[model samples]
Target: MTMANASNPFRGIRIGSASGAGLAGWQAETGRSPAVVHKHPVTYRCPLGHETTPVFADLAEEEIPEYWDCPRCGRAGSRRPGTQPGAVGPELYKSHLDYAKERRSPAEAEQVLAWALGQLRRSRGEEPAG
Candidate 1:
């Protein structure tokens, strides 16, 4: 049945109610609303080795489940290990690090490492060395 202005507390959002004269009838007649709906954002990877796209809030519920093949890899669905069908966060970060490593010269690596260490210290609320 179609819910009326359902509020999702976890996501801190509200789903608008479906319109129409027989909104209640439509809810009772069909198990779901004719209007498109969406739930939690589903994480998925684009085939092109690009960063994983965050949950697409604007996509319709039905279309959300449909696989949009990656433009680069031409693979359907986000790459996840084993039966777990979702984007792997660590893999994404590692891939970025690898890309940086490939692009960095020896001196650049040292500079980047120093910058990263400074960032880490700042994140931990520690003062960076001058």
Candidate 2:
């Protein structure tokens, strides 16, 4: 049935009226909404040029993180360079070889590779490649 045709049981009821007094008592006591808390916006930029600004609580600057995950590109982002104190430049990527070189000399690496290759060749019953 259409609402216009349906008869409301309390059609004439008003706020604070005897019929709606219970509803009125429980209704929001104030017409205005609660006050909004303070917020701080921080922008982060990824290497791919994606930028995202997220809101944080208006608190100490140190409380904010230095890096955040980019919502658009799924990469780690840092604050814009030279914008804030203690900002750091993007770290240079290091490969496994780079780290291994740091720990061992070229001669040692060659020796290890030769030993490993020898073991593999022996397991396969084949001569080791020079």
Task: Write candidate 2's Cα lDDT for 1-130 as tens digits.
Answer: 3133267654543444432333332233553334456999999987678889999989798899887766776556778653422326434446678789999999999999999999999999998786
lDDT of 1 at 77: 47
User: What are the runs in model 2 whose C-alpha is more than 4 Å off?
Assistant: 1-43, 48-58, 67-76, 81-93
What RMSD does each model have against the real structure? 12.5, 11.2
Each model's C-alpha lDDT?
Answer: 0.56, 0.69
Question: Model 1 over residues 1-130: C-alpha lDDT tens digits?
Answer: 4455457634322333544553444464565755664545565655444434545657656665544444455455453422223463223223566788789898999998899999999999999988
Model 1 has an lDDT value of 0.56
TM-score of 2: 0.44
- List the lowest-lDDT window of 10 residues for candidate 1: 81-90
Q: Judged by TM-score, which candidate is best?
A: 2
Q: Name the lDDT value of residue 22 in candidate 1.
A: 39
Q: How much lDDT does candidate 2 score?
A: 0.69
Q: What are the runs in model 1 whose C-alpha is more than 4 Å off?
A: 1-98
